[model samples]
Target: MDLLTLLDPLMTSPLLYPLLAGLGSLDGVLPMIPSEAAILTAGVFAHTGAPSLLLVVVATALGVFIGDHLAYGLSRSVLGPRLINRSKYARRAVAVAGRQLDRRAGLLIVTSRFLPGGRVTMNAACGTARVPLSRFSPASAIAALAWAAYMAGLGYLGGAAFVENPLLGLAVGLALSFACGGIVELVRRWTARRAPRAAGAADPGRGRSPAAASRGQVGSRRVRRALVSATAAVAVLAAPAAAAATPKEADRVGMRSRLDDVVATGAVGALAEVRDEHGAWRATSGVAELGRTRAVPAGGRFRVGSITKTFVATVVLQLVAEGRLGLDDPVETWLPGVVPNGRRITVRHLLDHTSGLYDVVETLPMPPGPEFLDNRWRTWTATELVARALANPPTFEPPGSAYAYSNTGYLLLGQIIEKVTGRSYGDEIERRIIRPLGLTGTSLPGTWPRISGPHPHGYLPTLRDGETHLIDYTEMNPSMMGAAGEMISTTRDLNRFFAALLGGRLLPGHLLDEMRTPGVRGASYGLGLDWWDTSCGIRVYGNDGDALAYRSWSYSTEDLRRQVTVAVTPDFRGDPDHVVDAFLDQAFCG
Candidate 1:
């Protein structure tokens, strides 16, 4: 018998799954591990009925998830980050992965599992970038499933074709995988060749933000020289210099110069505006799109993700101030039987995510591949989402005993708003905040998927059938987020709203005081607003929002004298947090 036939007993062994899981997890930290080959070999045995296809898929999927987390944990730890930052090659790989993730996190995660060394690099990059576990976990799971499916499918087909020769089946399966890899490389090359011409033809009106462009051009020569010199050393000094500098001397650092670094970190497009006593300083970087070289508009509108929570919370607080709803009142008083422990769950619990409700998004079966594209546009109602959350039991016991973020709580809050006000949350927000503040750039799109004004295309990257594809997710129904996170606003509007609210224009003093009271982490969450203490010991209050392809951040100093609002259209290309955090620190601490 051939070598493949000889290994049949081991492949069918019950220990196979655990072995794969162990190898897969180890492969995450060490890309050279032959986890893929072992998996493929297992597939060969499955073809001969020595191991079941289902078992093989399950084993590998778990293995991939476990492995990715292990790598991510390593990167997140102090020693790992230090080692990675110290290595030039690791940093470069991380930069590439960050950029890839900016475009298509799911696609890259799934496809990387097939390419030798791809998984290790991706996990390291994600860990280095500090991409939140909430985002990484689901994407990793989807990728694991895809990898299992693809490998098993190929093995099954080969087995069916060569029933008498498992050896030939294994060879056929391995060859097909290699063929897919070749196609991916070819497609990548073609795209690169077309990029320059496409960029050159882009409209000047759509060019990079002037300040960002100026900053980029000014330091281009110096940055290039530094990058070249970095080749000789494991760590680059220039990057840490700016980050390590004292806060008092921030002005000397130059805001424009910093924005250039931010753009270089992998943001497709970024715009930052700081309004202070001196006046206003605005900067932009990268391009509006990958192929187009246009700058982001001065005040372009974009999805404000969870930042919408602040607005929703503001309205809720307004109701509380007006004595329409009590903070301690049970949610059942407003929406009867919607929540499992409605009586024990208070309105404050909803706002702070201490309601113990399970996150609805976590309950659904989020499939990878083209399957997600089908449901991308599907409209979901608030009632439906609450039902989804209710389908799963509460994640914690004794409501409000612990802190956990639950979008379901926000949706429930939205329902309560409707019950108390007898109007949609959008209408209430428009009359109370948007119209009052004259935030013309902001709107509640409701079920409308299209962004109405001048805006950058929100790009999502994916790998389907072994070829990378960039998807324009610029438009999609926000009903899925509901009151929790479906609002849209520009950086300017965000700045205005936060400034006005913090300046004590939005709510009564008593309600505002209550809103700012920390319910979790001693300071992170208030009634609806959240605060973060900068590295330099200054506290900034605001909310951050994120969608599949767009992210919005708005924050201001405690005094509201200094404020910065940023909008970023993720290109799936790089880690932009370093730039963002630096800008915030300079804006506040400085």
Candidate 2:
């Protein structure tokens, strides 16, 4: 069953939902799951779900209490013991506490229970102090009950209060969790006040033995060791935080607000690039895809879709540079009598996409009207898809007429590149372009493994029998888009490609002029680039692409200073333009 379908009822059903929700919170794998909201949803479903209010309280109270305490116990057993063996201050503290307990007795272990590690080690400490289990169990139970009541009360009230709003629900959940965690700490201190007087723990008058005092000295040394151990333990635990603080750390730690906005807006995922020309700093966000954990690798490969058209334009321009092919060379000269109006249409017209080619999508229905082969299919020759497209025909527009984005023109270009270069399309891209520029992250996979290295599994949204699922779509046949849209790239590689392309590294000076030359109509698209002077300040030149559940786009400033911003995903979402717009808008350079 799909996740949303499976989770929805537990969210909407009051009776079973709270119990499940509480249990769900105990799972640490993804603590970010909105467990409180899940319970609040249960409250909303109270009319139909009929879980008694008290039942929710009991279930939630018991679940969180038991779970948290278990977490503490596990920490003591594993973490606390590990600390004492290695830590100097813990060793020192153990020594100090041992000396103190020898004279004043039972003070260190009992007091140690007040510290963070102490609370965790309370059960173990009581046992070590030689305090009987009967006494320790009753006291710890009382403390545990208080802790549960406070947490559960907060949860119940928070859920009841924010049944209508999820954002509010999350706030309340965190507050309650913190409040409960804090309260447990507070009560332990208050309970410690009457300790020495209530028990003759340190009294020489009491039946305390010399050996017993000796035991306290020994255990106190252990306590000193435990203190150093605990501090070191805390430091080790804080390492992830330290790692997150570095400038080169995750872009999230730096710009969570901007990233949060993207996710809130519901694009499967997004990545933002914020940088200064002098190589100062940049941040990234949202991640690469939905339902997966890998962030978009900075230098990695992803399909750029129609963006490949621009590269083809560059290659075609290179051929034109050698005087082998002319801008006005009839396509018929290269491939005899294939196009109906091949005699009239020029290579320049195709590069400019003015070749009035039929839209393959309009002709051949998209997502190709199949369940999209469950198994990853491989090795589709470029000509196969072109033949299917050519079997249909050109647009109603005469060659060299109006501007129309056509995949057929690009497919023709790939064949042209292969025919001219006498090498595989991908090999030519590497030898001529990527390898020369040091753009290792970029690749023309051409049905090679779809983008390797750390990356989130991309997925496609599908509704089957009325249930929605984001299906992992990491693999696909390049023949579908062929030369037109099938090149894979990463944000870093794409940026580098644009940097080289726009900086006049890919093509000769005059040919680069043709490459930058805009097309007809109000739109002046030069080859592969799509230009839009937004109401916002920066003038962007790049491509917008959509394939299955994936959407990708990249842009560079006209000067190539802000080289590229590419957002790609494994799963498709309803709105990509908005995703791009929002990211660019928030990317006000520092």
Among all candidates shown, the one with the greatest TM-score: 1
- Separately for all candidates shown, the number of backbone clashes (residues 3 or more apart, or on different chains) is 20, 28
Ten contiguous residues minimizing lDDT sum, candidate 2: 207-216
Model 1 vs. true fold: TM = 0.58
Candidate 1: which stretches are off by over 4 Å? 1-253, 364-368, 521-523
Q: Per-residue alpha-carbon lDDT of model 2 for 1-590, expressed as tens digits?
A: 54334545555454473464356336311234444455554454442344555565556545544543453333223243234435555434433332333232333333332233333333332222222223344444454444344434555666555555556856876676665556654664464453443211222211000000000011112322332232231111000111111244444343445444444444445554444353423333445544344444433344556666666677777777787668878888887766777888777777777888765544432221234443244334456655655776676567766786666777777777767777645556656776677654454544322333333344544445554444556654354565676665556666777778878877778877666677776766876667666556677777666544445667777787665464545222233356456555444332
Q: Worst ten-residue run, lDDT, model 1?
A: 207-216
Error of 2 at 123 (Å): 59
**Each prediction's RMSD to truth:** 19.2, 28.5
lDDT of residue 449 for candidate 2: 28
| TM-score for each model | 0.58, 0.54
- Cα TM-score of candidate 2: 0.54
lDDT of 1: 0.67
Error of 2 at 14 (Å): 86
